[model samples]
Target: MQKDKRTSLTDGMFLSLMKSSLKGISQVILIENAVTGFIILMAITIFSYPLGIITLSSSIIGTLIGKLGGANENNVNSGLYGYNSVLTGIALTLFLTGPSQWFIALVGAALAAVFSAAMMHFMRNTGIPILTFPFIILTWFMLLASYKLKAFQLSPGLVPQDLSHWTLNISGKVDWLEGSFNGIGQIFFLDSTLAGILLFIGVFWAGWKYGLFSILGNAFALLISFVLGGEHSLIILGLYGYNAILTSIAVSIVFKEDHNRFAPISGIIAACVTVPLTASVATWLLPYGLPALTMPFVLSTWLFLGARKVLPRL
Candidate 1:
């Protein structure tokens, strides 16, 4: 009887271990979605304007369909369905620079949505993990689109002057520290190195409440972009701000805490990135273009306030 009791206790312990393991897996899956969603949103914001609209619309549609079609909240299948297609659409849009690029962007978005749904369906039925399916489909689609699209040429009027000229013009008028501060203040004015610094400051200060992961992720993505020969433009800096806000929202959802202090502090840091330089640059290049220096901070404030409303309550 004692032996039988011992055996039963061992079985119970094993069952408890299994349950704990499953719970941990579920938590990880949820976190992964949060990360992926932020990444996709950042990608869209980086594209901005009409292209951002197309990418966002396609991703939202695809994610909704996947959720309804049997992709669970914390499953690998859901992540693939939601994020992969978004990346594919954005990538296609970037590669297609023709005058007819708008049409091509829409087509790419459609293709990504349809293919993601179809692939998810296939994987579900076969019981295979949908781990790499999105990457495979997106890569192939982008490659095909690139091959078919001809290079586009822009008129001289549409092209901005050399970076050096802009740099020299700004440097001549504003001292380095003052210029950097202004740049921080006007982060959304365009792509500038000062904007990058502000983003880093936001991530760092937010780390106090949300932990180090948010800052680490932003830095990592930035590092990767720099290594890939991408320009450190103001647009890219704006993208980092977008990324940090989304990440903060995600962490709030998962952890169920406000991190209220973190959000505004981060915003101030983001603002600092552009304020000094953006103001000076606008004054020099387009004296009437105050909007250029101010729009990003306005947008960031609006986005964060709206995020507070839309995000699931912790």
Candidate 2:
């Protein structure tokens, strides 16, 4: 009887851990469904097997850290700790090139969880979601560290430039179909066309509402970017669309309360707002050679969410 009880206890614990870890992955896109997480895992796997492994491992590490660290049970169970870790790990891996890339990524993942917890505590009074701020800040700092740290090697793909010497690369027309799909993929730092489509399917798999907002976000951003004379090259690469997609989903569904009748409209406005914010942020970071990352999304979402606290009608 004692052995049987122990086995049952172990099984329960294993299942709980697995579910929490999967929730972490899904939470990357701000969803908490395990099936959605599995589909996203498959999406990344189809792009690069090793990255898929790193993504899952990052989620598990974040989840375990939360559990072992004795964070709030509700927060840990909600997979709050895992999302930033996953992004930080994968971003570091892709942004840095060296023998120590993997080690640094793992370290960054652990640090991301701690940073996330700390940010959550600090931001608790503000009522604004931390969003992906942890990932953005950690990545920027680590990337900058490469200039000083011998062990940290920045990828050749990203280079600092003089803004006065830079010119907009608007050499071609944007492909509407590809841009829409790639927007979703870009949220995970993926540039693969197939991965984007698969990610769209994964988002829709979570809920029709989520999928709808994602499409709305992408479509609005596409039209807005084109109308605003955003660089055609960046549009084609889905750079301008990713932050909008994230902003729409976050404001429209993930954080919307049932009493807020204007959430959908607010989401639309927030999504459109990210377009100019993206351009401004990219230009601001141009001299430093830092990708805007999801800073636009974080800022735009915060703008609307914070305003709603006072405006109430918005």
Clashes of each: 23, 0
Q: Model 1, range 1-314, lDDT digits (tens) per residue?
A: 99999999999865533332222211211233233333323433553656546545555545545445654544423344444444444444544466766565555555554675666677555433343245344544454434345543222222334444444221122133333322222222224354334433443343343334444333433443334433355324344333333333333333233545455344434433333333444334332211232233334333444455565231
- What would the TM-scores of all predictions be? 0.36, 0.97
Evaluate model 2: give its lDDT: 0.90
Task: Give candidate 1's TM-score.
Answer: 0.36
lDDT at residue 66 of model 1 (Cα atoms): 48
Model 2, residue 111: C-alpha shift (Å): 0.5
Instruction: For residues 64-149, write the lDDT of model 2, one tens digit per residue.
Output: 89999999988888889999999998999899998999999989988999999999999999989999999999999999999899
Question: In model 2, where is the ten-residue run with the lowest total lDDT?
Answer: 165-174
